[model samples]
Target: MSYYNGKRVLITGAGSGIGALMARELASRGAEVIVTARRIEAARKVSREIRKQGGRAIPMLLDVSDLDSIPAFRDRLHDKAGPVDILINNAGVVFGGEFEKVGLAEHLNTLQINTMGLVAMSHAFMDDLLQATRGHLVNICSASAFVALPYGSTYAASKWAVLGFSESLRLEMKERGVDNVAVTTVCPSYIDTGMFEGVRNPLFTPMLSPQKVVRSILRATKHGEALVQEPMIVRSLDLLKGALPRPVWDEVSLRTGVASSMKSWKGKH
Candidate 1:
């Protein structure tokens, strides 16, 4: 049997891209999937497709950025699906541009959805997760979290916060005797998802597919792995950043085009 068989998995931002893909992947693995997105119709479409494929799934409206929506979302979940055994914080937005070029609202909204929303959802679901005999929290961070990304500054910062928060929460959960729950943080290089549509992949670092990322996530969750850095190149770059001096690393990044990969970004506007 698949490790995910019979597990109840809740994925945020399942309307499209990585979130929707994760929902489909988990359902295919025999998990009962709850697909939530800000848009009700979008969520419903994904849920319906999963059901048509003989997988268990339900759609729900969950706007993580709205604090007022969470309590009601929680109540609805409790009334419908009980506690989820796995929570995938996969909903995020990316706005790629130089710091000064982007509006302040864009930066703040990035934090609100990518950082604050993740935090709020985790807090709202923590108790239900604790109630499970075994629970997993999967956070979708990015390779950008590992280093400074010039053009994608705000998005990178939000991911950095997520990486830090995921690690800290993992340790806290362990120390609190919540051994049954595991936290996994995933940091993958540029994914081919439309979110980064025109962004260039740095030299030797290709864009990953959503399927590849979802597979890595499931493997990590099943084995209780703490961190997942995909494509090997991402890991190598992270190591290089740690070993090299700051200026040297920056120069290397510049030469490799890592520092300016987003120069051509035409992300979801």
Candidate 2:
């Protein structure tokens, strides 16, 4: 039987992009997918598509940034969706530009959606995960979590925070002997999603297609992997950055175009 068969999966930001793709794929694998997005129509559209493909999916409205609404949302899920075995925190937003040049609200919104939202969803659904026979928490972090991203400062900052929070939670779960639950953090280079429409590809790191990233995420999730960072170049990022002296690493980042990769970002999608 497929590992995903009979699983109950909930994916945030399933209106489009990789989130929607993952939802459809998982449903096709025999999981009952709860597709969520801030826009009700968007979520329903994905759910409709999944059902048309003979997959099981239901649409729900969610805005992770609005913490106050989470409890109520959880209550609604308890009543209808029951326990979610896999929770994929895929909802995120990015605003890229010079730090001070971008409005403070834009920067704050990025953190609210990308960081706070993930934290809030995890906290709300963790218990449901624990009660399940085998549970998984998939957080859609970013490669920026392992390195600096100039001109896209807050986006990097938000992902860096996710990396820290997710690792901490994973360790905490282990410390508490909660072996039934698995926490996986995904860190991928710039995806071809419109959210990063104009980001320059860093040397040796070509832009990734949404399909490629989604496939990797699902493959890793099935095995309860702790981390899923892609592109051959990204796998060694932390090691290279940590092994090299500060000055040398900075120089490497500059030479590799990492330092200025986002200088041309013209996206808010």
Candidate 3:
């Protein structure tokens, strides 16, 4: 199915990393893509590349962390393209610091961009998406949402909030018979993105490729899958947590060196 063909899709954090890749991929597939980031130059560069590749896309300045900026963001999008058919909340952050070492401001910053920003953007576009009668809200979460490892308490908390928020939104949408408007949550382990440039993962699970993630997300959304976990193994881990007691799993995880490996990576990074 040419699911993305002619679809109006808006992607945040589209200046670089997975967001940039996703913008290119979707646009290549015929989607009318609108990408946003804090830096206008980066967004314009990516948009230019997409257009050069025979795709439809435009660059816009957006700082998801700033709620006040959303109206202007929406206005720009509205002027360029009416209501978006797909809203991809792919912007996020990860700060590697001890729970206590990470100050309140930094922690709040994490929440602002990784959590609240997503919520605000989605909410801002809700009226448009609803008017379209058929649209998708895809929230990019992380495997960290499942478990909090060393030095990632804050990051994990933000992601966990995303997971919870997505689930609740799903329920609310279903009850309202908003069948045409869907919500999808993507939870993947460490992606080979610069965000985790100095970070490490001990799970030994293969990191996800940006292109591969985009493929999965597109396929799953087209197939009507409510959630897409990039690596199937992550799903198994989720199940394992439920099967085993929390304390037992925690002890095993720590003894298995996953925690240590994470710390070691932090030290090196």
Model 3 lDDT per residue over 58-159, tens place = 899999999988988798778877889999999887777667876888778999999999999989998877887578899999877887667777788899
On TM-score, who's better, 1 or 3?
Answer: 1
Whole-model lDDT values for every prediction: 0.90, 0.93, 0.83
- Assess every candidate by TM-score: 0.97, 0.98, 0.94
Error of 3 at 184 (Å): 0.7
Candidate 1 TM-score, true structure as reference: 0.97
lDDT of 2 by residue, 64-99 (tens): 999989989999988997989999999998888889
List the RMSD of every prediction in angstroms. Answer: 1.1, 0.9, 2.0
**Model 3: per-residue Cα lDDT at residue 38:** 89
lDDT of 3: 0.83
Candidate 1 lDDT tens digits, 36-135: 9999999999999999999999899988889668878888998998888999998899888878889999999999999999998889888878888889
- In terms of lDDT, model 2 sits at 0.93
